[model samples]
Target: MTTAIVPDPEAIRPELAQPGSALPVPPQGLRASRNAGFTSLRVGVTALWLSVIVLLPLAAIAWQAAGGGWQAFWLAVTSHAAVQSFQVTLSISVVVTILDVVFGLATAWVLVRDNFIGKGLIDAVIDLPFALPTIVTSLVMLALYGKNSPVHIHLQHTPPGVGMALAFVTLPLVVRAVQPVLLEIDRDVEEAAASLGASGPKVFATIVLPSLGPSLFTGAGLAFSRCVAEFGSVVTIGGAVPGKTEVSSQWIRSLIENDDRTGAAAMSIVLLSISFAVLVLLRIVGGRAAKREEKAA
Candidate 1:
């Protein structure tokens, strides 16, 4: 009688016999076969939508801005009014981002770590700025803090008014960003620190702040970009005062009204470029911070 020889499965696939071994990669043909046609269609549709809404508009603006030579672009961006508007826009954006980071962090921490009555209500109200129209927010600020109000402070037509409006509109960005990070944090880690006799400030500085750094920077970057593009609120409150309260958006509007389409496009490109650079810088810094936190962990 001839005996049948059995093949050992582990001998055939040595990786399966080892602990903590990675699975073998599938063949290219098998991997390709696993992708659904519906997934490809969905990806194509998403790309088409993004191209229509974002890429096309940006390309059009760039083409318009470059219609004239580089000399024209430089002159347009460096003009007196354009320079002043850029300054105003940058100043307001910086102030708004700073304030948002401070108050937003506190609010996010409270919402995530504490339990209380009306917590749901407070959480819902935090998104009020996003739900309300920018123009409506401007009007509310005017009503509360404008001239002849009970508080008797005149913020309208001033830099502070512009900053306040920007801050109000972007307030929720930081809170929303930080809340998710806070919720994901392990409470036991905090408890372990406390049990080691670490003070509240020390614990936060050593542990909490390191973990939260990336999210805070990301939120601030988003808020700053939104502030740079703010129009309705700043126009309503800041009044487009020449060399004073006029921001880049209002300045671009003025240029377009005067039939300076090239100038307006150039200024728009400059503002867009600055916003893009800041966002890129923030991402790089945030990425580094996240890596450091992971290494420390």
Candidate 2:
């Protein structure tokens, strides 16, 4: 058996190690050390911030909810008022989510595909809800659609009023989510499908809808979540009408105001559970969408 020998590169290229040659400024080890330090610092700061701002508060709410024991918690969450609030919230949120998904998609399409006068203003106005205070938003809705002579529309102090208010605040979530996805979609595919005798709707349903499924789910889910906890918007327009329009958040606030901390905590825990469920569903749907895209690709 014979073995091959490796050549000494330094011996063959003496100029490679000549003096006064430039080297890395801080050396690799020192650079790595600094990078590691910076990474550790960033992680530490992020963990600390999340712990103090988010995790700790959620843990505290859980602890408070647990203090009332299982039976009391159940009663608090299942009492007629609580059940009514949940029903009202869930029902209206369903309607609101449907409306948001439909109109939001239309709005996104127009914003991306249409060129019209004041398009820039319309686009900027889409974010107005995000910047405006919820109370202010409520007031604006009430003025337009409330019991008045201007529009001859009276949705004030009703479930429809509450739904309109929520739709106003949450429409932006759906629009923004779908807008970016729309911008990234390839128009050539749509054009090619149309040229292939696929009608406009057919092309959109087959070629576009699949790509937008995840974003629609994301935007609709977020809008529904926001609808669940909406307070100020409904407070004035919906008026916590118990079995009619009182949302989960309004009910919780009423509980707190009536000095029922245990009940408040219980209701809060229920809302948290609902949010967690939405999060889980979003994760499952998002994962399935990713797998489908991978398979298609």
Candidate 3:
């Protein structure tokens, strides 16, 4: 009788023992993965691209702001136009955020929790700002509120007109952000709260509010950023009055138009810094809220 010798399975696949490929072959029934390292490479490339496009521009402005040292940066931030623009921009953004949250939450709740005739039309209308150009929105606002229009008769002197226009421009942002979150929320949870003797307000305050917290903050942060950086819409209706209505973006544009590149760069950096700080704070708060929701779930 003749006997045949067979090599060991492990020895036959010696490549498995190499430094990088130390793992054994995946299960016999499972197919081997192709280019498993490709994911990491793709992530690296994406990160590099973002740094080049976003971070580098930000760094350049910051570098210029610091060129004359901290004293110069301080002056840029505290200068008359800079200070006034900051105050006005921040105040308007806060007001807009509050109003948007209230209206957006209510709108989202109605859209997701109730059924009505023309629901589809209402939903589509919520996103009108997304399709409309910002400049066009400004023009419409100007047409309606620029002293000649009937609506402007009462609102001509007040900031209310500009505020209303900015709100309309940013409405879709808040609604879109909150709608998905509301849709994902469990209807049964609210019903359970009711079954447990919780009243409507109590159920909303204790359950629904917490669930909606992250989305609200996220949306408000985005809306605030958009509003603060807004140029076309605000300028078209705001009149860009330096101490009265000039926003940071318009102020920066004026500086650049006057050929004060250094000053414009400095003002832009200041605006960017403040906006970035606010956005980061919002994101941190949103993260905490998300964690609480996860825990409750």
Candidate 4:
């Protein structure tokens, strides 16, 4: 009979035989295969989770939005009050986004670069909206800015009040998004550009803005999407004044209260559509900016 020989794993992997480093080591191919399997499993789990939480709910809404057919959906969305709500929601959301971008950037810059008394308190306070309930925020707004206030400034039942409430809720989104990016920015590059005779605005426009493009878009998109469906804060302040300060969420509620489920679904669909469209637009804009960055590199 012929003698049989088998290769030892320790011999195959010399590092495994090293003193104080003696450990079983899988072959490179096996390790790679295991990693690939784990990656696939993780991908599948993520898809399933998102489907259960986000996709399924969105599909249900879209299905309900079409419950009465396209004609009914169109009528529901185009009615006078519905159109007014759309206008108010869109206009306020746009203003909120612009304000968030400008102020969010400034707030993030100060928080990252400047140091002073109460700075830590200000940092924590920026996230207060995230912890506070939206209804409580509205209530606070009513107490401080509503009628019967010591300040004597009433904003209840007004569009600007609604806008202000939205801004308050969304401020943190932009700040948190931009703050990390601000910290990661290379000040040496800015100093280099300045040394090369680049003016302040020129340095910011060239060096700072490009790096911040994606983060700004992310923050703005989140703020816009969240504010679109914001119910508690806006509803309390705007008073659901139809064709005046009424927003999409309030309009949808009114529809449901009036036994118009289909109309409410249709209105909800409109808000979803607007949010989705804006996200897509931002994605495209950001992608193009990234390509430009690659080319510049």
Q: What lDDT does the true structure give each of the candidates?
A: 0.90, 0.91, 0.81, 0.90
Model 2 spans > 4 angstroms off: 1-30, 291-297
Model 2, 136-190: lDDT tens digits are 9888887887777288888887889999999999999999999999999999999
| lDDT tens digits by residue: candidate 3, 1-297 | 999999787677866565775666666445433454666788899999999999899888877777878776777778888888888787887888789888988898899989999999999998888788888887888778776886545343346766777799887788888899888888898999899899999999998887788888888888888888887777677877776677788888887899766777888887776689878998789778878868987
lDDT tens readout by residue for model 4, 209-238: 989989998999999998898988876777
Best by TM-score: 2
Off-target runs (Cα >4 Å) in candidate 4 are: 1-36, 196-199, 294-297
Which model, 2 or 3, shows the larger lDDT? 2
Ranking, TM-score, top scorer first: 2, 4, 1, 3
Candidate 3 ranges with C-alpha deviation above 4 Å: 1-36, 150-157
- Poorest 10 consecutive residues of model 4 by lDDT? 16-25
Positional deviation of residue 127's Cα in model 1 after best superposition, in angstroms: 0.9
lDDT per residue for candidate 1 within 1-297, as digits (tens), equals 999999999878976777766668787787776676667988999999999999999999999999998999999999988999999998878988999999999999999999999999999999998889888988888886788667888898888988888988898999998999999988898889999999999999998987788899899999999999888877677889987889999999999999999999999998889889988998789778878878977
Stretch of 10 with least lDDT, candidate 2:
15-24
Q: Give the better candidate number (1 or 2) by lDDT.
A: 2
Candidate 2's error at 77, in angstroms?
Answer: 0.4
* CA error at residue 123 for candidate 2, angstroms: 0.5
